[model samples]
Target: MPQSHPRPYGTLAVVGAAALGVVLAACSGGGPAPKASDLSSADRAKVSTGGTLRWALDAEPTTLNTFQADATPDTALLAEAVLPTLFTLDQHADATPDPDYLTGVEQTSQQPQTIVYHLNPKAVWSDGKPLSAADFAAQWQALNGRSSAYWTARTDGYDSISSVSQGAGPHDVKVVFAKPYAAWKGLFTPLYPAAATGTADAFNDGSRTRLAADSGPFTLSGLKDLKALDGAAVTAVRNPHWWGAPAKLDAIAFTPAAPDTRLAALRAGKLDVADLSRAVEDGTPVAQAASVPGTVLHRASAPAFLQLTLNGGSGPLADPDLRRAVAQAVDRTAIAEAVLKPLGLPVLPLGNHLVMADQHGYEDDSSALAPGADNATRHLDAAGWHLAAAPAGDAAHRAPAAAPVRTKDGRPLGLTLLIRTGSAEDVQVAKLLTDQLGRIGVPLRTVTVAGDSFFADHVAAGSFDLALFSWPAAAFPVADELPLYAKPAVQPDGSLNNGQNLSATGTDEVDQLLAKAAAALDPSEAARLTTEADTRIWQEAPSLPLFQRPQLVAVRTGVANAGAFGFTAPHFQDLGFTGH
Candidate 1:
């Protein structure tokens, strides 16, 4: 996968709307998302050294370890500056070996699918320990999924590795896969130090708040009081021992700032770079922020998207027909226009769940579930549900104030939709969905919950019939997203192992195609399989993709090599400010 952020299970995003609220006008004259990265580009020589880059973070990270379940995008940003990445994904989502960590990487064998990695001889840990095969083996052991002792967030490529050992020289590491494992380049990214993954206790909890060691261009310097939102929550200083190009900035301070506060922070010169991806809320003037003097507003097609997850573990959604009905009733294009158009982004509804719009092998799978109130009603009626107290075809059903309710076997066809409390975007989207579902005689209720405990206490716990959240995309979609849609299996102890598929519903055919996609060596074939799997997911109605969220950042005009990166990974060593 790309050096993308670690997958935070159901991260909520705050999107701002027009001052008059969501204008339900026809979407027109829109184009596909941009394929190129939008980071302000400049040569290394032009960038001056010895200045602090105060970057804004969305929130304080729950843990420093990227492998932990609670880790967020903040954790990934910290890892990118302070940890070594063997391969970095380009703007086209192609993986290329990073010379700072690996001189070369090649597949040496075909029978058992073996790969050899040539580690940079000068790359060493903060304590002077050389990076070796020991680090690779330790990470593999912890994330391979064979042992229950290690609590790993994801095990995509690692689970396929049969063994990791030393190869031709002391700096060469060999990895043998039990399967084809076409996404091998994604493994061991931001490779953890052996000391952090040497044992179960160390791997699970040791790095919750701190890093065991760092081996990159920068090192963790200090973590200010997290409760003090105005202070630097996390800081990284240039590493003098770095053997590659030295980091140009003297230090990077990650300060916690909400979407509404970033504009003021940037104008006051307190922040050098502010990520405005979540700066979407009601009555917020996002477009006018572009005129801020000495700053540039950059836009890039983000690898993340906002979506609605339909819980299939229990309740009315457990019935596939009802789930399909709910899916059909949603006007995705209208929702996209309401939330994204105000921010000056493309207003196209996302089609495929796995492949992003700007990526290769993308196919609109929305045709599987046709969107219309009449179509939704037909599905519900066929599933033995009928509107009670009023005629099924009455005109009053279309009214939002007194909509008719459906009932089957004395049970009302009512569902609860969960949204984070402070997210105006979530509230706006939910209200639209509530009106749409109500027209089909399905009563929908919106419930507000605390943002911090939203995912852990509700979404992950299967506590809602419908939930709204975002999923960050990666270069290797099949490897990264398989767990999200795979079927829950029964373990030997009669327990359920759902992996990360919170839907609680899946099919055998979907699983087979996803498995084939993971082991496919040819890129075209892998993409084809992934597209097919997405079609099935749409048919199953586990989740509905709304729109691709664009990454918008406000940065000082002189800042170089950093901003909205899109599909490309940020080159920390090349990021700095030019003293214009």
Candidate 2:
């Protein structure tokens, strides 16, 4: 991606609004009135008195602290209720900045480097104190100070910022950065309150049970009694003093429903909206309910990609030929058609690039590893291994070595493939690959690891030969991919670099490309550079691209304007109850 150019936020906003308008128009026949099924008929008959809207969420908040939680999506969703971002992503993943929440941005002589944003004139915390820039500074400092691995990664965007200053007014704040950053506007999520500073350690710690205060559209009203609700649920009432658009529903009650229970609830007219995972959508109940006249099922491509990460550093995967052979051994087309297409459209191929087609950095030029037994044979043959057609047939064998039979470093090639235990699909894929490799005269072993240890301890430590994993792509830009593939660096405290780069493969070229693209202000130029970098990365094949998962949301027919934000986010704000 091109790194350096300047563009105004106004142009971006207009483009975003246009894109969203087009999507909304396509989804609805021109903003029809909300349906009765969207809200309870009893509630619809009542006056437009705002009140709580009970909601069911699958997971609980992992942490009350925003900066401390990065891996889990539940944390971000909860924080959205408490803290507001300067800009919100529309249904098309376009930036919709809230100027009312921000007074002005002060630019230093260094163009895009040091920007000091003034908060809204009347902005105040839930505790009735003015919110200032110092709060942001303190929060960032506290998060960085604690040395939590997840928080450190989340705050990586602010690593360039040198300092933050608070002026006389609580809303007056200044931010100084070490270098010019083009995406500075993207960093303005809500900050912590001043009271959090006193319990800084406790606030920054992910172990905290209750959050201190909120500054967004809703405050933590109360935790629901699971016994009464029959599931994990929470209620968030609207903040009366909210500076932005007031929430239509007075309160949002979240109820957790299992994958199976969701469809039944929707069929029984129990829920206004429900999230549909692939496992749920493929079942007969959901399929029948989706086709029903009174219900509207909208599906979109999610901004996430399932990937197969190759162990590139050492062990059996050190040889590029072996990796290529393994890549060719699997039938991705069949996987897509059998595993994913039933859920939604099989829109694009899983190319070498890790990003989905909608992402800014996506490059479609690359080709996918061809499927079938013949192609697999060719790859195995090229890697100096012969394929045996049957079990007892000594029909295939390896040729004599030039010197001695050796691996990448004149050693034997042997390794175990690791995958998460609970995922049946992943286990099936791993076993299939293992069988294919066995035919090519390569010994392979499969092992299942616990989910927590698999991602945290094993992958980071480079303990496995190959693994199946998924990576999320942000809607803003492709510049955010730095932490995943960048080379690990030693910390000041002599700790190992354990950001997100599980493979531990660091390329100077990739780093330079990403840095330049991020620094570029122009979207087109940045996109171009990002595409080039993506091409390079894909060709290298550190991670093999899998299918893109589709976003499936089932809403009552009466629900109006419910859709996804491009492939980026689920736009809950666009949802409203339609009267019958």
lDDT of each: 0.78, 0.55
Candidate 1 lDDT over 1-580, as tens digits, reads 1111223423531110000100111212245654346888999999999888888987777777777766677778788889988877666566678898998988898779899999999999987999999999999999898998898765667778899999989999999999888778778877889998989988877776666788889887344333333344588899988999899998888887877788888888888888776765433567766767789988767877888999987888988999999999999989988987777777788888876676656678788777778898898899999988853444565743456789999987899998877777888899899988888888888999887667778877778999987777656567667767889889999976666787888999999998888787766677667778888899999999898776778888889988888767788888999875
Candidate 2 C-alpha lDDT tens digits along 1-580: 0111111110110001110001111111222211111112223233243644444455554455545432245455566666656666543345555665676665554654566677788777777777777577766565434444323334445666677788556677777777656566666464656555435465545223455566767776354222343435656777787766655566666666655567777777666666565334334434664664466666656656567777776666666766666666555555555555555554354553534554433455344344455665676566665433333433356543322222333345455788766565666567666665555455667888875576656776678888775555455544456666676677899865645565556577877887777676556666666666766665555776666655666766555444333343333343345552
Where in model 1 is the C-alpha error above 4 Å? 1-31, 34-36, 59-62, 146-149, 201-206, 209-212, 221-233, 258-260, 281-283, 288-291, 386-401, 407-412, 490-499
Every model's TM-score: 0.86, 0.75
Q: What is the lDDT of residue 254 in candidate 1?
A: 83
Scored by TM-score, the top model is 1
Best by lDDT: 1
Cα RMSD (Å) per model?
Answer: 6.8, 8.9
